[model samples]
Target: MNASMLSYILLSCVLLSVQAHNCQVREIIRNTKSLLNKTEESWSCRETAATPCSCLPIPEPGHELACFVEGTNHMMEHNMTTDNRLFLLNQSFQIQLDRNLCESLTSGKECKYKTKGTVKTFLEKILKTYQEIHKSRV
Candidate 1:
């Protein structure tokens, strides 16, 4: 085989790898956005004057872009796929929730009371992590 032909093959491989990486990043961003939306919806449904539940507040605009960049960087750093990161985040949130609240809700009991503070804390941690990721990228 000619040296030129070998070089062309190598270049093609590199380009393909880059494209694959870009695709993975895009998928991660999409999945993260979907998860955030779902979380916000659930929080809105649970929010009330007495037992308020809320997720991290997104800024007016450009928030999604920031989150996408942050998430992509984090996934890359951790060598994790979109689905894996989402699952880990969900598991972490669940673990951080108040045990009593979880049990009450899961055991078919009248869970009238819940600690909004705890939920807020969990959301803050997640948001802060992303913010740090974004800042580092910047």
Candidate 2:
């Protein structure tokens, strides 16, 4: 191939890689939002003790998930109710899996098989974290 043609091909490859990275980040974010939203809805409905509960997303760059709870009276409670406790336990495990997936993506690894799994995991983490905090009332 001509030198010009080769250069064009290389440039195209580089551009594609950059695009893929951005796409991956975007996908993760989208998935995280969906998961958090669903979890927040479920937790809010199930938890009777906490009023005006919510999973407030923490804004951060890249593939990271963090959340805080709002509208819970901490002084009145010290532990999570039975339903909330069980939900958190399941969600925490899911979050750990998601964290691993995010780490892979951030570390320059490609998620060829299933990116959705990672996104789902991070969302669970956000939800679980929100519930756990409300449960602890701290």
Candidate 3:
């Protein structure tokens, strides 16, 4: 190929690589959001308030955007798709930890409590990581 043609080919390859990188970033955000939704769902599905809460996988900071978006999607599903009032309360309870603990104790036998505590800790760590990432980006 001529020099000009070779240069054009190299430029195209570079541009494509950059585009692929951007797409991967977007995918990571989407996955993070999905993880959030699953976390919410697992919280909602409780037979009783007890020890050793069900463990949900926490998404990493690298997938924060995706996880956040997924969480939002889960919220919309609960609020918009369902007529169940408990879902709303569950969402609120998930946000307020001490309150949730009280409510869980009042509602169910001793089971899955410890697991919930662990989940809370994991989430806090993930949030901190996400914050650091955002700070760096800014």
Candidate 4:
């Protein structure tokens, strides 16, 4: 194949790869949302005794899964209420799995809500961190 043809093919492959990745993320968001909705009715009671936000770790860059797992484990280890579990799941969604903990996803806002503790006051700081990672933090 000619060099131009090869370049185009490579570009197409890259695009497809990215689309596939996005599709996977979207599917996860869909599934998590569904699961949460299924049990949402009882969430209010769970929130009545919400876990302290301090216990939630702000996942570092490239540590989305690790942080998520750790957070879940933390919750389970302490037998956290269902609301806290769902809260993490929802907040994790705003970032969609690739940002810092305190960062906001849609607004491009930085550290939008590192404080304040209440379920309703969230969106103001709902696991919104979605960083693009311009460079290494190290």
Candidate 5:
């Protein structure tokens, strides 16, 4: 499907998922911002892992992004094709073929590090996006 179509589907899932959990977008956005701040300060690229996609727990012993997902209690996991976390993960996993070569939690140090950079950049972007949205709401 085209990008617009895909986005519609993902948004649908997020809306449904939000209602199912009685979560407000405002709250999720607020929580996401808080988590992003902490992550940007400390996240790093691991040079090794016990296994691929291993759910070690936050302070998770693998890819930084995977650990972040775990902390979300899985809410950030699904219905979020639009969310940068999954999109970035999917794009990195599928598009960045070179990343598979590194000895990382699941990929390479460069890969994870690059992903961290992307996450940091996106964190800033999302923060700005939310700020704009928040301003519009007020």
Candidate 6:
């Protein structure tokens, strides 16, 4: 094959690879959002004493999921009476997750509660990878 033809083929391959990577990242984000919605629904309780409340799987761009909860008021001050004990339990759970994320330099804004940390790092990593692969396009 001619050198020019070979170069063209290589360039096309690189562009396709970058597109695939971005698609994968977007897919993950979608799945995570679905999971968050489920968590919020399950977590919302009319009575503070309700059992079996579900904990949401924290999204990597932590702030997005929290924003999702803003409308719901973090399940606080809703039809259900708020329980201090249950509130503390929820905060602790979020804090643990945030601590783990921060350890990896994946911190972002806090979640619905101030205790929750944003996981911007995970998304940032994907973005950085995308940028590297599509440097010419940017």
lDDT string for model 1 (3-93, tens) is: 9999999998886566333323333344455555544323332445775333223322223333323333433354333445566554322
| Ranked by TM-score, top first | 4, 5, 3, 1, 2, 6
- Model 6: per-residue lDDT, tens digit, 1-138? 999999999998886566334433343334334333333223332223564222222343445323323322343444222434334323433443344322221244444333222223222332343344345334
Clashing residue pair totals per candidate (backbone < 3 A): 0, 0, 20, 3, 0, 2
Q: Give per-residue CA lDDT, model 3, range 1-52, as digits (tens).
A: 8999999999988865653333233333334344444454344323345632
Tell me the tens digit of each residue's lDDT in model 2 across 46-115.
2235553222233233322222111111201322233343343334323433444234223322212212
Worst 10 residues of 5 by lDDT: 51-60
Per-prediction TM-score: 0.25, 0.23, 0.26, 0.32, 0.30, 0.22
Residues 43-121, model 5: lDDT tens digits: 3323346522212232323353333334233324433224554444333323222333212333322212223323444
Worst 10 residues of 3 by lDDT: 104-113
Candidate 6 regions exceeding 4 Å error are 1-58, 61-73, 79-83, 93-106, 110-138
- Compare the candidates by TM-score and give the number of the best one: 4
Query: What ordering of candidates by lDDT runs from best to worst?
Result: 4, 5, 1, 3, 6, 2
In order, the Cα lDDT scores of the candidates are 0.39, 0.36, 0.38, 0.40, 0.40, 0.37
Q: What is the lDDT of residue 20 in candidate 2?
A: 42
What's every prediction's RMSD, in angstroms? 15.6, 15.7, 15.2, 10.5, 13.6, 14.4
lDDT for each residue of candidate 4 in 1-138, tens digit (9 for 90 to 100): 999999999998886566334423433444344443543232221322555332444444444444454445544455444545455564444344344333222223222223233222221122232122211211
Weakest ten-residue segment in model 1 by summed lDDT: 100-109
Maximum-lDDT candidate:
4
Model 6, CA-based lDDT:
0.37
lDDT score, residue 88, model 4?
51
